[model samples]
Target: MRYTFLLYSDRADSAQMTPEDWAREKEVYGAYIGALQEAGVFIDTDWLHPAETATTITRKHGEMRVQDGPFAETKETLGGFFAIDVPDLDAALAWAEKCPAAKTGRVEIRASAMGDD
Candidate 1:
């Protein structure tokens, strides 16, 4: 089955990263991705721009409403995601725990809907 990992983090933590620190962070995550590929479970992954660049849209009373930033504000913001296929929730959870972001943030694991293919 395929699962989606909605990664979230405190934006402030990222801002504190030095150039070298950021580079090392990428290297660490790259290894994790590599591991997934070796295990034949990797599908896709990516990083997202800060929430400042986000545009939120909603429908209210038959009209579309737009907001300039994220729909809500919190210490933790949506960072990125990973989509992978694994045999079961336990396997997906293992991958989620291995993600570097999980050290300081969260990886929300969700099974893909049956028709997503």
Candidate 2:
């Protein structure tokens, strides 16, 4: 099965990260990604820009509407994601537990609906 791990964290926390903290964070995530790659389960991964950069589009009453920033106002914003192929939910959960965000933020695991993974 293929699962995507959506990482969410408080934007304020990221904003407070010092240069050293950012470097350490990179190293931590690097190790996590390396582990996934070594296990041959890594599919894809990416970090998103701040939520303020997002552009939202919606259609209602046959009219199109555009909005700036994220659709929801929340303390935690989606920061990144990792797509991996694992055997089952248990395997996916294990991987998600190892993610750095799982410690400080949230990791939402969603199985792929395509069923080809």
Candidate 3:
């Protein structure tokens, strides 16, 4: 089965980290990605730009409405995601545990919809 891991974190808090801390965090993530690739569990992954760069679009009364930033305000913001093929939820959770965001933020692990196949 394939699982989608949605990583979320507080951009404001993360921005406060020192350069050294940021480098260390990136090193951890790089190691995790290397491990995943070696195990052939990595499908795809990417980091998103800050929410400030995001644009929201909606349809209101048959008209297109455009706005800035994410649709909602919250302490946590969507940071990145990874799609991985694993044997079961346990395996997926194991991988999720290694995700950097899991330390101070959140990692939402969900199985892909069957209809998506």
All candidates' TM-scores?
Answer: 0.93, 0.94, 0.90
Tell me the TM-score of model 3.
0.90
Order the candidate numbers by TM-score, best to worst: 2, 1, 3
- Find the 10 residues in a row with the least total lDDT in model 1: 10-19
For residues 1-117, could you state the per-residue lDDT of candidate 1 as single tens digits? 999999999988878789999899989999999999999999999899999899999887789999999988888998999999999999999999999989989999999998876
Better of 2 and 3 by lDDT: 2
Give the top-scoring candidate (lDDT).
2
Candidate 2: pairs in clash: none
Candidate 2's error at 102, in angstroms?
0.6
Off by over 4 Å in 2: none
Tell me the deviation in Å of residue 15 in model 3.
Answer: 2.0
lDDT (Cα, tens digit) per residue for candidate 2, span 26-110: 9999999999999999999999999989999988768999999999999999999999999999999999999999999999999
